[model samples]
Target: MQTEIIVAGFGGQGVLFAGQVLAYAAMDHGLHVTWIPSYGPEMRGGTANCTVIIADEEIGAPLVKHPKAVIALNRPSLDKYEPLVTAGGLLLVNASLIDRPVAREDVQAVYVPANEIAERLGDKRLTNMVMVGALLGATGVLEMNAVQESLKAHLPAKHHRLLPANYQALEEGAQIARETLAQAA
Candidate 1:
């Protein structure tokens, strides 16, 4: 299996962290993975994005021109990357931040109210985890257990207390995605 994914958002939206989690999960699952991140010069509120590639075999490059999946956390990200998704690819949109709907019919678009969901979960920082959960639910690229394990492995010990909340956010996002899939079916 081979999957190329792009996650994009503002600088503080945890886009790179989300990509890192996916890479870690892929590695834990015994797959080859590559993660490349790009961001604007400004630290906060600047554009940020990351490309992740996971494959069962060797990966030749880290850059992705047309990804198989995209997680767009803001309107800018949606505008920039939505059209570049490969045909029949998956596009996960953060509905809370992006009011514009994806226009493409070639790819499946899954909308998750990431910011709102994160807020409801009592912390807005879990937005990326929500997107990741939606991605996992929609694509099944990485198992949920693998993602949870990856989260545990990557988070520093000091922040371990927040794991449950993060896990809840992930599950909530997955539930939203599952509901969307059910409705589509």
Candidate 2:
């Protein structure tokens, strides 16, 4: 099976980092993976996005015209990618920064109050990890343990102190998605 994902938001929202985490987890699970990040020169507050593709077999291309999933941390990102998600795919929206709902009915949608959840965990920067967790829980693309291990293995040593809050943010985000799934069932 193959899954293509796009994580998009303004710079400093960890959009690239979120894609990196997914790539690391896919590699750790012995899957073929590709990650491509795009950003403008404005850096922080500028548009930033990354594409991640994971498959059990060789991936033919790096760029995707339509992704299986999208994690949109802001309204603009949502507006851009929501329509591109494949039918029956997943769409993870960071509701704290996005005021509206997902308008598409064909894709499974998970709304996460990422910024608020990260703030409760004592680090607003972990908003990316939270969205990553929501995607994992909503789509079952990768196990949560795989992501946790990736976070541990790939996080810089200087920032290891933030691991606790980061882990918490991930769990809280997953819980939100899982609860949403349960309600749907």
Best by lDDT: 1
Which sections of candidate 2 miss by over 4 Å? 39-45
The Cα RMSD of model 2 versus the native structure comes to 1.9
Writing each residue's lDDT as its tens digit, candidate 1 over 63-144 gives 8789999999999899999889999998999999899888999888899999999999899999999999999888778999
TM-scores of the candidates are 0.95, 0.94
1-185: candidate 2 lDDT, tens digit per residue: 88999999987899999999999999998999999986456346578999999999999888888999999999989999988999988889999999999898888889999999888888899899999989878877899899888888998899888888888888888999999989977
Summed over model 1, clashes come to 0
Give each model's clash number.
0, 0
Show the colliding residue pairs in model 1: none
* Whole-model lDDT per candidate: 0.91, 0.89
